[model samples]
Target: MISITNLSYYLGSRALYENASLHIKPNQKIGLIGLNGTGKSTLLRIINGEYQADGGTISKAGDVTLGFLNQDLLSYQTDDSILSVAMQAFARQNELQRQIDELLHEMETNYRDELVDKLGKVQEEFDALDGYTVQARAEEILEGLGFSTDDLQRPLRTFSGGWRMRVMLAKLLLQKPSLLMLDEPTNHLDLPSIQWVEKYIQTYEGAVIVVSHDREFLDNVIDVTVEVAGAKLNYYPGNYSFYLEEKALRNEIQKGAYENQQAKIRQTERFIERFKAKATKAKQAQSRVKQLARMELVDAVIDETARVNFKFQFSTQPGRHILHLDDITKAYGPKRILTRADIRLERGDKVALIGANGRGKSTLLRIISGSEPVNEGKRQLGHNVSFSFYAQHQLESLSVEDTLLDELKHANPTKSEGELRGVLGCFLFSNDEVFKKIKVLSGGEKSRVALAKVLLSQANFLLLDEPTNHLDMQSVNILIQALEQYEGTYVVVSHDRYFVSQIANKIWYIEDEQIKEYPGTYDEYEWWMEERKEQEGNSKSVDRKPAPAPQPATTTPRASDDERKEWQRTLKKLTQQAEESETKISQLEERKKRLEAELADPATYGDSKLMQAKNDEYHRVKAEISQLQDEWENAMLEAEEWEKKLA
Candidate 1:
């Protein structure tokens, strides 16, 4: 457990955190969320003791170990295999292992009672520490984080920065310290790897504090929300979704208090103006003036929720069909990416391209954008179709010496400065920020610049690769709004499920070296895929053998009439039991949904005891529903058996 009391941190003359207080309990899962440049990562570093607080105190036990997985770890290079690097988390175990090995080697030459006793003690400690299984455990975590089993033997230096970050993540996760801190852990992870990490974090015994922009990940893995705003750390007793609702409620209260105080100030000023001119009520007016001076002002709540109003102007509307790829075959050396893949893009399709890493989603986007030539395919562009491509690598292409205004001006020279400024404002760059050089911008800032450029391209079609990367929740929302208003076709490749679910009208994935399309939203696509998988599993499990040729039905005393009647009755009873169980599950599900809605209310969060009680009830209802569903399944199976016996 750790307690940060009245913590203050400053960046230059600006206060990043002022009198911010937060109590972190043991095993508490907290999501540290805020807009870009709000010092979420700085707080993490402060907690990890990389930086000292300017004021106040951070108190924790001496033995409370901290495991930090940060972007700086990406630069850590080692010739050691990734497995060895991850295994290094077990420092004491490794040293014990060395001692045991040295003792065994010495024993080969000289075996003594003291040496034997030492060997036994070391071996006992090793086994107790589970040192023998450390390598396997490290490999499992690395693979879960997206490394292949073969990749475990590969040198850590050989991987890209993203993969290297994952190796570092695996190392920290394996360490399993008293407190685990991850900053933007999902930035380098694919969907599967993110999900795996989510599951791991949800069950981890150690406390975790994560600074992430991924909404769904936070909702799934974090129970507490700590927001950095107005140089203060605000605590919410629930997840991100609850925090949103709770913040709205608190904002409403603040708005009312602010309005009341302003009205009182105006009334006092009027009284002072009216009576100060006269000698009769001068003392009372002066007293009111003093009262006004002593009154602490309530800060107005500024809505950080962003909406993009800038229309993405295009020169011309593309034809009904934007582009088409027929029998596309793409390969790099012996490694094939796509084989005979066919895909069609329509004029107004908002498509989300999602899949695991190494699946060539970017390669496919490049091929579609005509930046990459296909080895074998017919790539056709519809009439009057123009496209702009945005990728992370495009940030490098930006003129670093150019100011933000200059960058936008270079992107579209025809647009007036006023018009460009308006568009930049929509992307959260207003006034003086537009003059900041592109080189000095953060990754999220650079991403916005790139996205703004794409919008300014005057192209009818856009190919965006991970456009939501490095963006905060507000920025992602702005993008979602911008894409919704844009009158064009775009296929965005992203691992952000929440963003995809919001903006995507259709889903695309790479399977069997072919681009596949699902004509629905991401949520719908997931549902359909689950159903398809279940059906496929059932088909594979079911025997496809031909039925035995039916001989003339022989009554041959197979069963007595009483026996048949009894079997039918048993089947009916079993079916009835299953139906009752199903009904109970449905009721519990509705109850659970109701509780969830109530739990999201700010009033519920105000009461810690009520919050804990509701949470316990919610999870209990979930377990009850699961148990009932399983029982229903067993009952159905029994009913089917009875029916078969009757037949």
Candidate 2:
């Protein structure tokens, strides 16, 4: 548990937070949200102790631990293997294993009763610590984050920046600290991996605070929402959808109060002005002035910021057939990523390319764009198919020396200065911001500039790979709207379901070296997938094969009274077992916490004999606790099965 009181932070002259206070309770999942410059990441850094708050007090429970996903992979030790780095999270488990080894050796030579007891205790401690499964858990986390088994043995330096960040994420998840703080965690993940993380965080035993621009991800993972705006923090008691509704309600109420207060002020001022000159009414006018000054004005609701309003401008249309690919096969050495894929794109078509990470989604896009060559395929472009390709890596390709205005101009030399400036303004680069060089811009700013250049190109076809990577929700919405209106043929690779649903008219799903096409909206595709999953669940065998063909019914039969009573008795026993197991688990958890705290105390390490006895008892209790947890889980599962049968 952590508490923040009167937290204040400043970036130069801009006040980010002023007297912002928030309390994070155990098992609370909070979504930290705001606009680009509102300091959500800074707040996370302050909480993680990487940055100091200008004025605030942050208090935490004495035994609480923190885990933060490191965004900067450059600081990692690249010389080490990926698995080795992830295994570092299990420092305590490794230490206990070492102690167990020493105790075992001591017992072999001098087999005293106390030494044998100590060895047994140490082995139990090792098991309780999950020392045996540390490597397997690390592998599971890594695989879930999109790392292959071979990649685990590879040196960290061999991975690119994005993959390295995944490794860091794996390390943090393995740490399983008391509090986990993540900023834009889904930014680097694909759709499947993002869903995996959502499930993981939902079930995580500790508190979580996440900052992300992915609205769908936030809606899935967070139970509490915190908005950072107007130099204050506002709390909402539900997920992002609930927060939006509640925020709108509050804004409406605030608008009404503000309007009433302004009306009262105007009335008071008018009365004072009209009566101030008259001698008879001078005293009344002075009282009115005092009343006006004493009134507590209500704060106005914050208005939505100006959004980018540019659309793709095309001078010429492409041929009816924009692009075509036949028998496309791609592979990296021995591993085949894609095989015999055929696709076609027509003019004015908008397609969404989707798949898990490293499943050839981006590769297929690149091949279609003519940026990557296929191993065995032919790519054909239609006549007059002028196009612009925007890769995620291309965001960093803008010349650092070029200003925002110059970048747009370079994208289209024919455009006059006025036209270029107008386009820049549409992307929220107004006045002096247009003069700022690209090198000094933040990642989001650079991304906006890149998008502006792509718009200026006015190509009839567009190939976009992760265009919403650094974009905020509003920007993504604007881009989606623009793409929807454009008459160009486009294929976009995106993980943002909302954006895809708005812009894509068709879906291209890549899975297991094959490309599947669905002629429907993203929402429709989602519904179809859910329906298929439900059908599968219905057909799935539950611990047994199908029954053999039924014999001719001699007579209609039902359960006897005795059989019904026995079934009811069994159900009741299962329910009772579930309740009792839950109670015991809670009590044992409390006792385990107390014992852990005592063992963590520095004074406990001073006396070897006393420490040994306490540790032996601690390990015994922990082993029992593990067994009890297993039984508790089984009991709950059995109870649910019985309830389902009764239903």
Candidate 3:
């Protein structure tokens, strides 16, 4: 329905696109992918006419409606109810509705022939436009995007930023334009909302162009992939996986050609060098030089940016049982989230927490991380456990006044400047980027910084909530690789099925106020769910009764009074040990900070003997700090376990 012929665009001195062209056909779903700042959004804006291309012709079919979901908020609806905002998408239908009503009112009052004829005509138009069902359709889309019935009446200003984005998305979906352009439509959506969008786009009659970091969503929705790199656009005939395979195949062929060309050039150069002065080879040498000048060199197929290289460094190894939750329940007044949820996590276990929106996946992660208290539950951290948490909103904790480098430096003041820069480099911040303040960073940049902070902490356990929310595919893959290699236990709550499948060995599915554990990967869990669904359908057909519940197991005998008293002493001793260990860790960190400061000085490097001595002391202090941290965590975990037993 739309075509771009010889399109060219520029951002100041940078050429975002040069003679790039592509055609978008009706009912085609295209995924636009590139690194950050590669003009994915810029190209969308150009297509939407928000920005004119430097030199390009974007021709559209006559009377084709367009809906572009950029960051720009819809105008003049901040105080309106969400339903009212969505209903406005059907302005033509609303007008038809009004005309029909007017004609009916006129016919009822005057009973004239002209009024009756006009009423019939208006009703026909309204019926053709589906005006009568617009309200119901709007409500359905809202509900699919995770809004409750009551939420339809609430003003848009009452919702959080993420929820408000959903409201805008609902309006766009309701509009159902001929060409829909969505830029990161899945950024703030939960699993159910994303699924709704996936299904909607798959069945949508119009064409769609989306720029998303969500690999799995794209794989399910898009039929074509447009890759923007190196000031050029490449089209893949299939989805993301196919794009990968196809790109590799093309690169291999290009590489072979490049190698052959280089070999011929080398042979020509050798002949020239060996016989340039001889009369027999003069013409050939000149011919080879001309050929070299006329040759079109092939650019090496390499990543535009460096991949992240880092891993979670653990100071201590937790016990066999990493965590245990007994009879856990959580509720907010009348709305219960989790009920009697009992779970045991073992060391080295990677669990993916999956559930619908508002179904307690994040709530469960919070409860395990001890950031939120359970209404009724007894939980214990195993001995030597030390953990870090990354919440979806964790980026909000960054200081606006600090630069990216400063914020990371504040986390570990003892880290040398060079070491800190190395970590930042792994996260893709370098040169002047390190000096950019947190307030100026984009959401994805902030998320990357938050993640880098989490990785730098020496924790044996990781509790992540929507860690991939704003990350690009490259960053997500980097994280997946790191987590896959991590030696500690982790429980991640993510809606990215591809990422979850890459990292999780087990699945913890939350539904109906209960947690169900599946002992397999995400793909396996999907198969298991499908099989169970089939079994249930067959049983329903047979009209059989449900099976009986199993009998409860017998309890172990209680401990004697002397044993309990010894446990009390042990708890007291552990508490004191924890306090002492913390003090030692603090002392070491202070000494390490001094050593790092000394190392930062140019004068210290000038004296080789003194530099070596300080460096030695720095290494010793770092190793000691790691040991002290392990001791501290071990003491704290043992104390918590003892307290649980005594209770």
Best by lDDT: 1
1-647 in candidate 3: lDDT tens per residue? Answer: 88998889988889999999999998899999988878899988888888898887999999788998876663434888999888989898888888877877777778988877887887888889888899999999999999999989999988877788888888898888999999988877888899999999999999999999888899999999999988778899899989988888888898888888888879878977887788988888787788888988876667533455564566555556689988899999999988998898988899999867778888888889888898898888875688889986788999988998889887667577788788787777888888899999988899888887887777889899888877888788778867877788999998898999899999998877888899999999989988999999997899677778988989878889999999999999999997787677667767887898999899999999999999999999888877876776678778879988888
Backbone clash numbers for all candidates listed? 0, 0, 0
TM-score of each: 0.83, 0.78, 0.80
Tell me the tens digit of each residue's lDDT in model 1 across 333-379: 99899999989887799999998999999999999988898899889
By the lDDT metric, which is better: model 1 or model 2?
1
* Model 3 alpha-carbon miss at residue 520, Å: 2.3
The reply for model 2, stretches above 4 Å from the true place, is: 101-118, 272-299, 305-311, 413-422, 532-647
**Best candidate per TM-score, number?**
1
| Number of the candidate with higher TM-score, 1 or 3 | 1
What CA RMSD would you report for each candidate?
A: 19.7, 27.9, 5.7
What is the RMSD of candidate 3?
A: 5.7
Model 2 error, position 4 (Å): 1.6
